[model samples]
Target: MAVLCLMLLLLAGDLAAFMQPPVFHPNPPTEYRTPNCAQFRLPGCPRDLNPICGSDMATYANECTLCLKIWEDGHDIKIIRNEPC
Candidate 1:
């Protein structure tokens, strides 16, 4: 029937919308600033892994991608100041 076809079309549209991956761009208008946690300055570590730009309260899952960018660009990262939590 016409009603059944209309319902199926609406359901398909709604499902398609939800299937797309969600994008989280916090600062859309501003330039994307990658945090400088940099290399593991601390010595005597089993393995040297770059630090991520997240805090005790929250974690930025996107930081892993940012770290890779900094490493590839050969940017020297240093913790200039301790940010207040």
Candidate 2:
């Protein structure tokens, strides 16, 4: 009986951990997009989006927005977040 109770507890813990949601999401954040999805950052521009990166600043930002919505709700994205703002 004691062993069975311990097994049950362990199973519960595993389930709880498994129940947690993933950090990344299918969609991007609306407010966290890049500047030039296809272009790179210039001298003064400090572009946001990078064509090679995940998504364009605007597109990816929109998609990544879901991440914030699901995880960091009501959170503001940093301009120079990953790379140049």
TM for every model, in the order presented, reads: 0.31, 0.32
* RMSD to true structure for each model, in Å: 8.7, 11.9
Displacement of the residue 56 alpha carbon in candidate 2, Å: 12
- CA lDDT of every candidate: 0.45, 0.42
Candidate number of the best TM-score: 2
Q: Give the per-residue Cα lDDT of candidate 1 at 42.
A: 25
Give the Cα-based TM-score of candidate 2 against the true structure. 0.32
Model 2: per-residue Cα lDDT over 1-55, one tens digit each: 9999999999999999999998764445465343332242222233344322233
Once fitted onto the true fold, the runs of candidate 1 whose alpha carbons sit more than 4 angstroms away are 26-85
For model 2, give the RMSD to the true fold.
Answer: 11.9
Candidate 2 residue-wise lDDT at 28: 52
